[model samples]
Target chain A: MFFIGWLVIIKNQKGKSWIKLVESKEIIEIFFHGRGGQTAITASQLLAEMAYEKGFIDTIAIPIIGAERRGAPIMAFTKISEKKQIRTYDSVKEPDYMIIFDTSLLDIPRIKDTIKEGVIIIANSPIPIDTTDFPDNVKIYIVDATGICIKREFMHSSGPILNIPMLGAFGKVTGYYDLEIMEKVLKKEFGEKKVEKNMIVATDAYESVKEV
Target chain B: MSKARKDFTQEQETKIIKGNVSAAYAAKSARVQVIGAYPITPQTTVVEKLSEFVDSGSMPGTQYIKVESEHSAMASMVGASMTGTRTFTATSGQGLFYMNEMLHWATGTRLPIVTAIASRGPAPPWNIWADFTDVISQRDTGWMCSFCATHQEIYDEILMSYKVCEDYEILLPKFVAYGGFILSHTSKPVIIEDQEAVDNYLPPLPDEKGWPHIFMDPERPMMFGNLIMPSGFYSEFRLKIHDAHMKAKEKIKNAAKEFEKSFGRNYGNGLTQQYKMNDAEVGMLIYGDLALQMEEAVDLVREEGYKVGMVKLRYFRPFPVEDIINIAKSVKVLGVMDRATAFGSPTGGPVSSEVKTAIEGVEKTAKILPMIGGLGGREVTLEQQTEQLKILIKMNETGDAPGDLFHGTLWHGKLEVE
Candidate 1:
C-alpha cells in the first residue's frame, strides 16, 4: 500500500523530525496562482500539514484570496519556522519563493509583489526567459516546466503534475524540509514508484539550480 | 555523488495528447458514473475520450451522455450530481457561454459537480482555438474555475477538483480549463500513477449515503426555482450563494490540501496565479492562450530594461475582486488584455471591464488600458505585444490613455477616431 510505505519512510527517516521548529532563518511564503481545480491552496496545506505531523513547528498553510469557485484564481500559502507561535493568519506578503503554475501569469500584475530578495521563481513556460533586468538581489529561475513535463510525458490532462518535480527542487534548494521527509510523505501519499519519479525530478531541479 | 542512488523509475509514456483528453481520463479513472457532454472545439476531445472509454469498457459502471447542447449538458450534470452520482461534463468557447444559465442554477443549488471547459474566443465567424474571454467573461457566475497550465496539472486538478467541489463546505460546482492550444494539442509523457495512488489521494465522498442534500422531498415537496416576490427574494437568493461561495473558499482550500497530502502534487490557493511582480512597476493581466504569449512578451520587455510582470486569472467566476485591487495597488500602470471584445465600452475589452471596476476603489491612479487582441484565432505577434508593453510602461509613468482598440494585426496602421 502506498500509505503504508509512506508511513514507513516517515517513521524510518526521522520518526518525528518536523515537529514545529523553534525558529528558523525566515518564514517562507509561496503563492500558487491557478484555477479552482488546479490545487492552488491544497499544495500549501498538504505540504504544511504533513510537515507539521513530522514535528516541524509553526508550519502553516492557508489560501488568501477568492471564493473557491471553478475558474477562479485560488491563492494558498505555507509558512514554516522553528518558532512556537505564527501570529499572522494572513496571506504571504513577501514570499521567499514563488511558483508559477501558469507562465501567462507573468503578464498579470501583483504576482511581482510575492517575490522578495533572492526569491526563487519557477514557471511553466515553453521558452526560456531573459531575467537580466531582474533586481541584483533577485535570482530568477525560469523553466519550461510545462514543456519539459509534456516532453517527459508525466503530465495528465486536468493540470500540470509538474508540481512534484517543482516541489522536489523547492525542497532541495530551500531545505524548508528534508527531501527525505518529502520522499516519505510522497511515498505514503503517492506510492513507491510514483515517489521515485518525483525524486528524480526533484533531484534534477536541485542540480539545474547549481548551473545557474 | 557520495550517496548511493536507487535506479530511476520513469513515468509512463503515451501517444498524442491534449489537456482535455487528460482531464477525461482522470474523470473516467475516478469512476464517474455519468458524463454529460456537449460538443465544442477544444472541449470536444474530453467527451470524445470519455465516449471511447465507455465504448472500450475501460471504464465500468459509467454512462456516457451525449447531450444536445452545452445548456443541456450542464443541466444533466446538475441533476446527476444532485442525485448522489459522481458526474462529469465539458464544453468550450460559445458552448460554455451558452451554458451560462444552467451554471447559475448549479452553484445556487450548491451542487458538487465538475466540468472541463476549453477557454476559446466567442463567435462571429466561428473559429476554434483558445482564449480566456469565454471563461473570464463569466466571472460572476459563481462556479470555482481552475485553469490548467499543463496536462499534469490538468490531471491532478481534475481529481483534486472533484474532492474540493464535493466538500460539504463547498457544495458549489467547479470549472477546470485545459488552456486551449497550450494544453489541448500538446502531447507528453504523463505519469499514470497507480489507480490505488489516486484512490488514496481522493477519499470517498461525504454524502456516501446518496445524492447531495437538496431540499427535494417529493412527499411534502419544496419549491426549487420558483418565482420570488420583491419582498425578500433577492436577499434570500443572494445570501444562499454568498454563504456557499464563502464556505466554498475555505472548503476548497481544505479539500485541495487533503488531496495534496494524499497525492505528492499540490496546487496552491488564490483567485489568480501571480508571476514575477515583486519589483515590477507595471503588470499585464490576462487569461488562457493569450496569457501564454504575454508571459513571453513580459520577458522580452524585461530584457529591454522594464520591470514587467503578469497575473493569469485562473478562477474567473467569483472574480477575485479584492485580490485584483490589491494587485493593482502595487503597480503604477496595468495593461488589461482581452481576447474578446465588448463593443462601445470605454476599454472595449472583457479584461478591462472588471479591472476598471476594481481599480476604481484604489487610491493611486493606475493607467488602465484595455487592449483587445487574438480575436477569431488571429495570430498575435511578439512585436505587437512589445509595442503594447512599451505603451503600458509609458502610461504607468504618465497617466494618459492612448485610445487604441486593437494593438496588433491589421489594427496597428488604421486611423483611430479622436
Candidate 2:
C-alpha cells in the first residue's frame, strides 16, 4: 500500500553491479498465508533475501509467531522498498500481493477478508481458485508447488518444502528475482549440498507458473 | 580433551538477521570471554546463536555455560566476571525477574557484566511479548539500562555497553533491552562489523590484577559484600554507584560518538535522539520498537500539514535528564509513550514518570502527556500513531486531550472486551 519508486542496482551476468533506474518502482507488500508445516514462514524470509539480493534497499520479514501447531494457520509478511527504508513492524493490512501456500486457506474467513482490491494473488494450487467474490482488479496466478515438490521428492518430515517453488513462481510473476538469484540465495541459506534438489522444484514452479 | 580450535576469520557482511541474533553477533564481535546462557522466548536466540558460534569455534576460547535457571545464569556471569573477564548473558520477562537479586549483586560488586533483555510483559495472564516493564522494573538495581529501536542498534549498543560498563571509572553492569518479537523476532539487514573494528572500539580485557577496587589473590586475602553494620560504608558505596551512573552519561556519549565515527551509524548523543524536532510545536518521546514506527507516523502527518516531531529515548537508567529538558523546551506539548506499565505511578507509565521528574521546576517547558500502548505484542499501526500525532497537535492548539484518557494518561488501542 506504500509507494517505493527508486533505482535497482542488480549485478549483471558479467559480475558487475549494474544500477538501473526502475521505471515502475511500484511499492509492494507481500502477505504470506499458510498453515504450519507448510514452510510459509521460510518462504517469506526467502522472498526478502531474494529481493535484497536483487537490490532492494530495505526489506523486513515479519512472521506472526503465536501458538503455531502442525496444522494451524500461520501468517507472515515481507515489506520490500527500493527508495525508502522499510520501517514499522506491524503486519501488512492491505497487501499488493498475497502468496497463498495452501489453497484451502482461502476458505478461512480471515484470509478471504485480506484479498482486497487491486491485489495480485500467487496461489500454490494445481487448479484455478474461485475469485467470484474478490475485489476488482484482483489478479490470481497458479503454480503446482506441492505437486512439483512431490514429483521431485523434495519434502521435509512434515510435508512438502513448498517455499522454494512458491518463491520461484513469485519470481516469474513479479520479475523481482530470477532463478539465478534464487539459486544463489538457496546456496547461501541451505548450503551447497541442498541447492541442487531445491533448484529442481524451484525451476519447475518458475517455468510452469501461469496467470489465471 | 579440548578439540583443535578453528581459526575464525570473521569478515564484515550485511545480512538480514533478527535482533537477538544481532546481540549474539555483537557478543562474538566483542570477543566476550564468558557467557552464561538460560533460554527464554525472545532472548533465547541470542544465547543459542552464541552457543552455535562457540561450538563451531567461530568464537574461539569463549567459555559458554548452560545454567539451570535464569538466577544461576546471572549468578554464573557474576562469578565469571569476578575473575576479571568480559562476561555476557541474556533473558526476558520472568527470566529477568528471577535475576533481580543477582542483578543488584552485579552492580554492587562492580562487575562489568553486560546482559541483553528482550523486554516482555510480566505474566499473570501468560503473555510473552514486547513490553519494557521487564527492564524498567530493574530501576533501583543500580545497573545502567538502554533501549534499541532497531535491530542494528542491538548490535551497536551491546558493543557500546561494554565500552561504557567496563570503563575503569564506571565498573557497573548494564542491560541492553529491545522489544520482544517486534524487534527480537523480526528480521532486518544488520551489518556485522569487522572484528578488528569491534576490537578497536571495545576496551581491552581486564588484566590478571583484576579490578582496582578488589583483588582475589590468596596471598592478599579480601572479603566482599559481607554483612555491613548500620555505621558501615554501605551508604557511601550506594552513593558512589549513583555517581558512577551520572559520570557514565558523558562516557556513554563519547562511546556513541566514537562508534558512529568507526561504523558510520549515528545513535543521537547516546542517550536520546530526536527526529525533526527543530521548529516543531509538538513532539513525541518514544523508545524500543515503537520509536522507529513513530518516525514514519511523524513523516505521514508532516506531509498532511502538522509540524510534529519525535525523540527516541535510548538510555533509561541515566534518565537523559538534560536531553529531556532540552526537548521539552523545544516543543509546546511533549507526549511520552511507554510500552510498559507502572500500575500505581502518577502517570501510569515508567518513562512518563521519569520525564515528568526530569523537567520538574524547569521554567517554560512543554506540558507533559503520558501514553502507554502496544503492550503484550499489540500492534501500534502507523494509522494509529498518525492519529495520536493529530491529537498531540490539537492539544498544542487548544489544550484538548484525547477522550480515552484514563486518569490523565492515554491508554491507546484497548479493545472492548464486553
Candidate 3:
C-alpha cells in the first residue's frame, strides 16, 4: 500500500511539472533601492526586454525618486509577465524583491520601508545584509560586485552595474529562465566580449549561490 | 486650384542645424516612436522641433508626451521604451541635474532610449553657459555618454547614439549633444540623412518572437524579484549590469565605426581624439564645447615654440579611466581645464579627478593641474590660457605647484586691513 501511494505521488509530481511548463506565468513587482548611476532601472529593463523578446510582453514602471547626485540612494520598480496589458502606474506597494545597490545605504534610517513578508533582498556588497529590522520571512543575499569588477579588470573601483551577476543568481533560484536565454539576452543587451566574460561570471555566480 | 508660375528653379541648399535641434531632427528621422520631455533652456529647442514635426504630421505613430518636469520626462520614456518603442528626450543644465534620479533608472533598465542634452553650468544663482560639469557629474549613471562639438556632428551622433544604443550588443541608452550656448545658438549646415538611409543603418525595432515577450499573467502568476535568501543574490546581479556597460563600450565603438563605414562620414568619437598630441610635451584636456577653445589655444600655442596638444573628451560617462591614464603617461605636464568647479577641493574639475585617479601609480615626471575657467560665460582667452600653461610648465620643471585655486572672479578687493 505504501509503494502504491508513493507511485501515485510521483505521477502527481510529473503532471504538475508538465502543467507548469505550459500554464505558468507571473507578474512580479521588484523594488530597488539604489542611488543615481546604479543599475536599479537597467535591471528591470533587461528583464522586460528579455521577456518581450521571448513572447512574454511585460510592462515596467520606475517612479522618479529624487534629484540627488551619484551615490545618493533612490528607488525604482519593475513588473513582468505573460498576460494582458499592465496599466497600473502605482509604485510597487509590496515588492516581492527588494534589491539594494549600495550596502552603505543600511546606515540610512528607514531604508527598510521596502521590506515586506517573503520579500527577498539582494545587495551588491561583500558584507552580509543588515536585516535586523526586517521580518522573519525576509531573506537576504549579498555579494561584492565591486570586488568582482576589479578582479575582472572592468573600470574605476567605483561601484555600479552589478545587475548581471545578481540576475544570474536570481534566475538560478527561481528557475524562471534558462542560462541560454539569459546569455542571449546579455549578448543582445551588452554585446559579445562583455557578454562572454559576464556570462562566465554569471554562470559562476549561479553555481556559487546556495539555494535557501 | 490654379497657381501663378513663379521662379521655382533656384537651386537652394542651406538647412541650419543647431546642435540640440539637429539631435531632435535625427531622432525624429530615426523613427523614434515616443518623445517624452519638459522644456528647459538650451535643450528646449530639441523638443520644440520634435513637437513641430509631430504636429505637422511629418512623423506618425509617435507620441509626443509632455511631462510636468524633467523627472517625469525620463520616467515617461522609461515606460514608453518598455513597450518596445524608440524613445527620446532632451534637457539642459539644471534640467539634467533634476533628472539625475531617473538617469540611472533609464540606464539600469537597459532601455536603449536616446537623449540630447544642452549642457550648461549648474546652480547657485542659475547661470546659463555651456559647461561640461552637468554631463561630467553624471559620468557614473551607466549611460553611454558622448559629446558633440559641432552642429552637424550633433545630428549625426544623435542618430549614431541611438544606433549604437539599440544594437542587440549594446542595450543601454545614450546621451549625445553639444552645449546650448555654443551648439544651440551657433547654427551650421547638417546633412539630414534620408529616412531610407537611416533605416538601413539601424536595425529593425525589437519584435515579438522567441525573445522574451512582456505581458500580465494572472492565473499562473509568479514574482519578478522575490525574496531569495543570500546563500548569494546581491553581488551576482550587480556584476551583470556592470558587465553590460563595460562590454557596451567596444560595441559602441564598433557601431560608430560601422556607421561611419556605411555613411562614409564618421561623426562619432573615435575613442578619444588627440589633436597634435603625438609630439607634444604639454597637453590640455578638455571636454564638450570648451574643448573647441582648448583646440584653438593649442593651435595658437603651436605657432609659438610650445609643443602643446589638446585631448577632446567625448565619452565622459564611462569615464574612460584606462585611456586617460595611457595618455597622461606621455605628456610631461597635463593642464586640465573645465568650466565647472567642485567647491573646496584640490581638483576643482571632474576631469582632473578622473585623471588623478587614473594615474595614481604611474611612475612619471608628469604634473597635472586642474583649472576652473569660463564659468558663468566668463571669457577664457587664448592669452589667459597661454599664461596658465607657462605657469604649469614651470611648475612641472621646478616641482613648485601652484595653490588649488588658480583663477576666479574676486568678490573682495585686497582687504584694506593689515
- Positional deviation of B361 in candidate 3, in angstroms? 1.1
Each candidate: chain B TM-score: 0.81, 0.97, 0.85
| Candidate 3 docking band | incorrect
True interface contacts retained by model 2: 0.62
What's the DockQ of model 2? 0.33
- Work out the TM-score per prediction: 0.58, 0.95, 0.59
lDDT of 2 by residue, B1-418 (tens): 0231224456899888888999999998888889999999989999999999999878877899999999999999988887777899999999999999999999999998999999988998888999999899999999999999998999999999999998889999999999998889888899999877777787566565647455355666678788988899989989999999999999999999999999999999999998999978999999998999999889877866789999999999888899999999999999999999988998999999989988999999998889989988788887678767877898998987766689999888777668
TM-score attained by model 2: 0.95
DockQ category of candidate 2: acceptable
Candidate 2 vs candidate 3: the TM-score winner is 2
> Which residue segments of model 2 deviate by more than 4 Å?
A1-26, B1-7, B214-221
* Model 3: DockQ score: 0.01
Which has the greatest lDDT?
A: 2
DockQ of every predicted complex = 0.02, 0.33, 0.01
- Please give, for residues A19-127, the per-residue lDDT of candidate 2 as tens digits: 4444453446899999999999988888888899999988999999998999899999999987788778888887878999998988988779999888899999999
